[model samples]
Target: MLHIEDLSYETGGRTLVDAVTLHAAPGETVGLVGPNGSGKTTLLRCVYGTLKPSAGQVRVDGTVLDGAKERARRIATVPQDGQSAFELTVREVVAMGRSPHKKFWEPDSAADRLLVDEALARVGVTDLAERPFPGLSGGERQRALVARALVQQPRLLVLDEPTNHLDIRYQLEILTLVRELGTTNLLALHDLNLAAYFCDRIHVLRTGAVVASGTPAEVLTPDLLAEVYGVRAEVAVHPATGAPTVTYLPGPRTPHATTAPASRPSAEQKTSAM
Candidate 1:
């Protein structure tokens, strides 16, 4: 479980995130959704310990997460851009996730290798186990990075756009795998449909603040979508599955009346009918 309390961050006299507070319970998948420049990435960086917040705290299981080694052991992150300095094999890359649990000079043990293999299989990339990370495609590379995070055996998984370059199949595969693992997950996702289908809850961000947070059914309303995303949509329940579905409607071609409907007297309607 993870808890973020009143988190705030600023840079160059502009706030990147403002007093945002949320939590992810164990076995829950929470999606962070918003348009570009909505501070989703900045908030995720703060959660993953890459960027410290100017105020407030990130906690793992009631313990503050600032420079805490134990907290690091419980939290794992897969960033949007998968960067590697060395030409390590996929298996080797995944084995690095175990570093938090090992001593500085400790070598990979048999158990570590098993974990790496399991992680690869879980992410459906076991065949790429022997491949060099640098030689893989973007989607493959992302899966390998996710495998690395999975091998960490984290209590909480934080992903920043894990599906950034992935195709539809792999996107579902990755998110489904995460859901099956039942770890608390806080994911920043750009795909609203994917978020609606996969996430148990969603947090909508706008201009560095949490504008809405609730179940996908509750947060993905037409009004919220129109206001935050500037798109008018028809929100309805899926006929087959009963999930919320959003369909966009074209905006008015010309300026339309912005007033409420006018009230009419019953007598006026009767006289007109006569």
Candidate 2:
């Protein structure tokens, strides 16, 4: 389980994550969603231990995260943007996740290599294992990064924009795999439909604070969508899966712009104007 208690991160007197509290039950897939610059990435960074929270505490399975190595053992994170200048091969990158389990300067054992290979195959990147990380396409890189995280086999997985470069097919495939991993997952996703499809629960963030959190059907109402995202959207149920489906229209309101109508005018309005 992952638990965040009143977590906040501030710098230069500006708060990026504001007193956010949430939890993911064991083996649950929880999603974090917000518009661009809503502090979703910043909040994930705090959980990943790269950026320490200015206030509040983060605990995974009752263990308080204090340092890099300890946190690495408990949480495996696929960052929004990975450092691509390492000049490492895909297999090498995935192998690096095992570092936390090994002593300094120790070489990987046979079992470690087997786990890496399994992770590569699991994410459908086994063919790219020998290829250089920088040479692969964006979607390929994302899968490779996921493979790395899986090999770590942490109690919790933290991913930011995991489907950023994936095609529709891979997006569904990877998310399905994540759900079946039997581990706690906290991901930041831009695709509302994917979040609704995969996450057991979702926490919506706006302006560095959590505006709502609940099951997809419970929290993804049209009113909340309009208020938090400033977009005209509808929440409906999927026919096959019976899950929430979100449809976003073009019209939206901005703080500086007037609110768009909930629904567009009918043909009669245009004919009368003409």
Candidate 3:
């Protein structure tokens, strides 16, 4: 389980995440949906320990997580724009996920290698395992990163824009893989339709605050999209999957950018777990 209590982030006198509180239960998939600069990335960075929150705490299984090594053991993150700066091979990159479990100088065990190989295959990046990290296409790199996160065996998985660089097919496949992992998942997604279909609950953020949160059917109305995104859109329930589906309408852009009041955190605010 993952719990973020009254989380807030500030930099240069600007608040990016403002008093956000949310939780994911043992095996739920929770999504953050918002326009650009709405603090989705900032919030995720705080959760993964990349950027410390100016206030509030991040907890796993009811205990606050502290220290990079300890956080790595429990939370695995596939960042929004994950790219390797080093000239490592794909296998080496994925193998790094095992570092939290090993001593400083320990070599990869056979079991560790097996896990890496399996994760690579699962993400369909086995063919690129020998390739240099910087040489792969964006989609390939994204798959490799997911493979790395999988090998970590984390209790919580935080993904920001997990489908950003993928085509339609791989997008579905990757999200399906995430769901099947059955871990607590906290993801920030730009694609509302994808969020509606895959996420068990969705939190709508605007201007660094959660304006609304609920199951897709309850929160993804045309009015909400118009207010938060400044665009006209049509939302409906999908007959097959019973999920809310969004069909954006082409219209003159509106300046209706006022955000709704932030949703009050409740005891039952649902969050996904891994």
- TM-score per candidate, chains pooled: 0.89, 0.90, 0.92
TM-score of 1: 0.89
Q: List the residue pairs that clash in candidate 2.
A: none
Q: 81-123 in candidate 1: lDDT tens per residue? A: 7878788988888898999999997999999988988889988
Winner of 1 and 3 under TM-score: 3
48-143 per-residue lDDT for model 2 (tens digits)? 988989999898988897778999998999987576887899999999999999999899999999999999999999999999999888899999
Name the runs in model 1 displaced over 4 angstroms.
252-274
lDDT of 2: 0.86
Clashing pairs in 1: none
Error of 1 at 30 (Å): 0.9
Q: Where does the lowest 10-residue lDDT sum fall in candidate 3?
A: 265-274
Sort order, lDDT high to low: 3, 2, 1
Q: List the candidate 2 regions with Cα displacement exceeding 4 Å.
A: 252-274
Best by TM-score: 3
Residue-pair clashes, model 2 = 0
